[model samples]
Target: MGKGGSSKDTYNIAHQKGTPGAGGNRGDRLIKEMIHDPYKTRSKLPEPTVCPECQALFQQGRWAWAEVPPNANQELCPACQRIRDRAPAGFLMLSGAFFQEHREEIINLIRNKEKSEKAQHPLKRIMDIEEQEGETVVTFTEIHLPRGVGEALNRAYEGELDYQYTDETSILRVRWHR
Candidate 1:
């Protein structure tokens, strides 16, 4: 039990940090501003909008791979915008001797994973794949896809997998080496 309350009240106070009657001090009442993504729309975009670049249909409050309906408004989907800007929300890095040896297999696995994820989610996409001096860097439009790809690689190849998520920059970095 917390100070001056039953377990349920204590639970509520702990869980609802800034809510009313949470029994917190002034600092706890202050609502922190959400981490901002510059690409995210400030307001809900009009429904049934389609991206001109990739033809991704925005309908039913989400983006999907549906056929563009008649009289749909044209707008750039976030994934295409991110691709055009080359500003990836996620990065997957592959390195080490084993990775260099099995590069083609790894890349094929990544592409397959991306294809499956992109079929379901229009926003999750691979922006680019670049080979640096000693590492292969793959960038994604959305932050979660890289992590998923890294986990898939780890599962298939038994590599060393690590993830770093930066809240300030709103990016997820996934590294896999075997």
Candidate 2:
């Protein structure tokens, strides 16, 4: 048996080896699943994330910046990373006869909505827009853009809107049709 203080220290060290963030913490994978609180602060990150691709600043746990930082580097923020990899966090598809007839208006509405959203939360971005034969697909860097668009369309045009979220990919799929 060791000294009382030494034995207590040993127990603490052994328990800490299995705690989260520890080198050997992988055994407790359950902790990663039930605590996906995105609103969590970024104070823990080594350095504030600044995406060189899009010049986004992750300040206060948000991707919003008035101007690029003097120390900005090419560190890809989560939004830019997803955009660069062509993996959107949210998807919106506009279809049906009404959409085809009013394509320009709908597109403009989406753009305007995005502009306002970006003004407040820079992380909300439209990754890409694809115009298909009878439908248009909009890829978003975050889930809120697609959700806002769907809500707007549903309220304004009384369109048939359906939204589904896939946890596997952490992406939201939204569909709107007249």
Candidate 3:
């Protein structure tokens, strides 16, 4: 009726029974269902963002998570890494004469102090003990100490003590000055 073929031919071509486009609408509907109900599929599980060191997820704050290589030397976390990296070369610079004379006494004092303090302060731990140049440097894990411990230690040895405290860690640099 329109041009070459009759009205039925034109209608059949336009309607296109069993044509490929007939399934296009069904495909689109399937996609919409998949988008709306993603959980229906097994592959749609959520992934987690977690720390490689502590396996703790990063919630909120000023913190960093380093991406460590697989099978590499995985030792310290970012905080410990920074502390160890920035550690002074001669941590316990002690003079030969002073160290030789008072090495045992100093070590004993440190051990005793650690034992006594640890009873009250669970967070406190000795990191390192060394004698370099003319000083004995004892490093400790950062902790909130009562005022008495510092004073008592200073009085017991008649030595000077210095400490630095951060939110997560503490560094105590103790030196005996002669």
Best by lDDT: 1
Residue 157 local lDDT, model 3: 51
lDDT against the true structure, each candidate: 0.88, 0.77, 0.42
Candidate that would win on TM-score? 1
Candidate with better TM-score, 1 vs 3: 1
RMSD of 3: 22.7
Instruction: Give per-residue CA lDDT, model 3, range 1-178, as digits (tens).
Output: 6566997875566556444345453212333222221111233212233334443222233123334334432333332433355442112222345445776875676567667765554333355666544456555444332233345546765554454333222333333443
Runs of candidate 1 with Cα error greater than 4 angstroms are: 1-32
Error of 1 at 105 (Å): 0.5
RMSD of each: 5.2, 8.5, 22.7
**Number of the candidate with higher TM-score, 2 or 3:** 2
Which residue pairs clash in candidate 2?
A: none
For residue 5, give model 1's deviation from the true position in Å. 15
lDDT of 2 by residue, 7-107 (tens): 77765765663564445553335454543424334444434557667676766555677576676544666676677778788899999999888989989
Question: Candidate 3's error at 26, in angstroms?
Answer: 71
Q: Arrange candidates, best lDDT first.
A: 1, 2, 3
TM-scores vs. true structure, each candidate: 0.82, 0.70, 0.37
Give the TM-score (vs. native) of candidate 1: 0.82
